[model samples]
Target: MDLHPIEIVGRHPGPKILILAGIHGDEYEPIAAVRRLAGQIDREQLTGKVTLVPIANHSAYLRHSRVGTDQLDLARTFPGSADGTPTQQVAHAITGLIQQSDLMIDLHTGGLAMEISPLVGYMLVSDPSTLQKQRQMATAFGLPIVWGTTASLPGRSLSAARDANVPAIYAEWGGGGGCQAAGVAAYTAGCLQVMAQCEMLPSPAAAAPVDRCVIEDDRDTSGHLQLNYPAPHAGFYEPTLPLDSTVRPGDELGRLHDPFTSHTTTIYSTQTGRLFTRRVLPPVEAGDCLAVILEDPAETGTTNE
Candidate 1:
């Protein structure tokens, strides 16, 4: 197996925290945050070890693809085989690195399929001790949303961490397919908060507050999304609602058209809630996802109205 690439920023003899990002090439927010943290954090203040793996899948990242060249999802192949494919080797190496750390924080962001909320996901495992630590870390981050997977995801990741007896939490922020400056900052802050949690850095006074989400599945609880399109003829696409807008069932979302024929197609929402995510461009193919509707059970609040 190819040896994992780990960059140790802080000295040891204290606690150990592993910061992993770029498992998926498309998700650039986490990678960028790690880069900033590596340069910003003062080495002298660090009490333990801070290992940074900025690009876990360098091969896929270079090609700007989500999956590895072997058509494998590297994240799903943890505890991999020693003589397995290239992706599997990489996964195994990452798993080994995690085994040596006291805490693991895997950073991620929304992908092309959907734009998820700025939240941290703590995948529930069988170990109570690890679960408690995961919760503590999540709460410390102070992210607006904290989602619990309830169970470990299939394949690798949280499962491997469990097998290795390491406390790991996956924190996601911003929409991966697009760039958001504010979203990036929020994620970076959340990561920095980890230092305080591990006691590697000084904890703040009682004044440093935090938020809690009763349920992590904010999108599902909010509402269902419905896509709307008009007669279908268009030149490019233009959206009206923008992203993260709260809208009712009949609200106008955007329009599409055939560039050559100059035909216009109108799009609308079918549910009352918020616009959690939207397409970045226009002139998409038939059945292209233009926007998503996140219905709030309370029927209120949007990321950005």
Candidate 2:
């Protein structure tokens, strides 16, 4: 794996903030955003050090696939072993980078299957102070939504960061396996805001605070958030609602049509929330995620409940 680091150190020593993108090869917006930032940021104007890894998974990136040549997901192989697969070795190297940084931002998108709303996510850690720091960084990203989740999927970059006691935020926007101009613009602006908040760059007028929500999945019975809406069977999907649409329980989200048999299955929302992600591509296989429903903060009675 070829790892390239774009480092900009200020005249005065300060915090070291690491920005990462393209962990999933098909997610193009963040890759574009970081590349733009790499060229646009003036090292002389920076107060601290900023290191950007525009493409983290080189093999997958080359193939335009989410998984590496071995079919292992790079994001799910964090803190990997030295004698493991190529993806795992890459993960190990990235974890090393994470350990040396004061703060981190992992950029992501919906990848090949879906399009996502602009949002930032911070893991809920055991330490209150660390959790607060993560939240502050998420807020600084200036996105419309800030999601807090306690459950960290094994081997995820954020999970590895937590193990290293590093404060990190994961930002997601855009997808469908292609780059979007609006997505690139949003991510670029958000990264700059994060740098300003980290004191690496001069602060601009504060970005409007976002709507914070505690995202809980099926793992927690009391938690109402249902992150995934999967395709029931292989078919073509036609979305009924637009992205970021406020949805109520039982609202029709879309329809799955089997062209061969002319059979149509209607998909409905199981929770009251906003549609944060949706599959834009028509063709889908069984069990593919069709949409992601994030529980509405107002409906849940509190933002972080």
Candidate 3:
């Protein structure tokens, strides 16, 4: 297999932390943040190694879609097959890097139709050892919000590293697509802090503690989300709480209907939690998703404040 060239700007030594971004391709914030971080890294601060693969999925990135050219989710094709499709080849290359890594931080962002907070995402595995390491890495970043994913078991993107006994965590921020200024800053700072934790950099800035929440892996945990704002009939969508609000069942999140005909329909939260994502464009179809609940705070520990 031809090795994908990963750029390095650190001194030769110490622990190695692999910062991978763009597994999904269209998630622009992570790629942008990596670019910004790469430009500012001091190679002399010398200690451990820091290797960055800012764009892992070249085809998906080029197409501006989540899936690669083969319509395969690159994140799921771990320890990939060399003789398989192109997506698998890319996955194999990434897995090789992770195998040699001491720690890893996969950067990500919400995609297509939803936005997620600038938070650290760690898979909540049942394995005691894995869980412990995940927690340690989660706390190390110190972002204001930590999101745990209980789904996508041991064969996904970072799974190879975790299986190899490496401590890795995924960091996410900004979204619907493109680099949001604040999100870029948050991710860059968090990434550096993680590198410092591994001694890849000296005296990296302190990371602010973020609220921790579990994004339950269930029938609803989707890699690419589509939030449909349905209209009871058809009209302009007038929203009340912008996307990503802490809401409760029966709480009116927005209203939709005929603005010209005066036919109004109120959108209510189906679950109690924060509204982390929604449709940016207004207007809706009958029975469409007005908004989505990220987690039910009481059971999930998510907070909007």
Candidate 4:
């Protein structure tokens, strides 16, 4: 779990920015995006050091799964131990890198399990300056959505950033395995945009569109995508509505059918918002999160950097 990161240093001194990908091995877009960034970004065009970890979890990637051979989620084992399992060692190393940097951008996708809309997110931390920087980075990412959620969750790279007082943000794109060209391109430009926004790049990156959706929720469960729309029974799930569509309460999300028992159950939405996440894989266990509604958000309007 060495987590060998690529470091690009700028001619001039500036912030040390860390950009990570492949926290979950099945998420392919981020890995490709980071690799693209490494080739595109030149030290002469940058004002600070940019560290890129294209494949943060090699063990899982080798197995073509989300978790490592140790069966531990690297995302949930942050600030991990040097004397622990492989995933824990990887987490510990990444957390050390996060603490050593001034800013961070952790890229992600839904992996092989679900499909997620392209969006950038940050924790709703108590520090105003850090929160503001996070917002700036999210806007600069030039994605369709900007999500600010609760900062209380533990065992994450963002949590390590929160504790280290380092400004950080994560981006999610469409996922269901394989590298989506659009997602890779967006992520590549997004990282450069963030560098420009932070004055690390000489050229100004493309500005985010006027109508980009911005949602900030500080509730305890704001960004937990795994808790929405639980399946009634273990079965094959088929979603009704498409991803990125708005849904009101009672809207049918999907159907669950117990393959052996032939029992079918239709799942409905419990909240109103965009359907940001929906399980793409058919088989699911009882209580597995089937759909995730973003919860109707009163637009925060165009956020300034």
Please give each candidate's TM-score.
Answer: 0.72, 0.90, 0.77, 0.95
* lDDT by residue for model 2 (137-235), tens: 888887887887764556788878999889999988877877889888878888888888878888877666566554533233211122377789999
lDDT for predicted candidate 4 compared with the true structure: 0.89
Q: Better model by TM-score, 1 or 4?
A: 4
**Taking the tens digit of each residue's C-alpha lDDT, what string does model 3 give over 221-296?**
5322343334466556666887657888888877776867866777787677777656544655566555656664
Instruction: State each model's CA lDDT, in order.
Output: 0.69, 0.82, 0.70, 0.89
Model 1 error, position 97 (Å)? 0.9
How many clashes (backbone N, Cα, C below 3 Å) per candidate?
A: 12, 0, 9, 1
Model 1 global lDDT (CA atoms, 0 to 1): 0.69
Summing lDDT over every window of 10 consecutive residues in candidate 4, give the lowest-scoring window: 296-305
* lDDT, model 1, position 177: 69
Clashes of 4: 1
Query: In model 3, how large is the Cα lDDT of residue 289?
Result: 52
List candidate 1 stretches off by more than 4 Å: 1-6, 9-12, 176-179, 204-212, 216-305
| RMSD of every prediction | 5.9, 3.0, 4.9, 3.3
Clashing pairs in 4: 272-296
| Arranged by TM-score, best first | 4, 2, 3, 1
Candidate 4 residue lDDT tens string, 21-136: 99998999999999999999989888989999989999999988889999998998988999999999999899999999999999999999899989999999999999999999
- Writing each residue's lDDT as its tens digit, candidate 1 over 1-305 gives 54344554555468788888888877888888888878766667777878888888877787777787888888778877778988888887888888888888888775554455666767666688988898888887777666555454445566677787788778766553665677667667777787788877666444345555534333322222123333244347677875557788778887786777756767888777556566554556666566765443344444322
* Better model by TM-score: candidate 1 vs candidate 3: 3
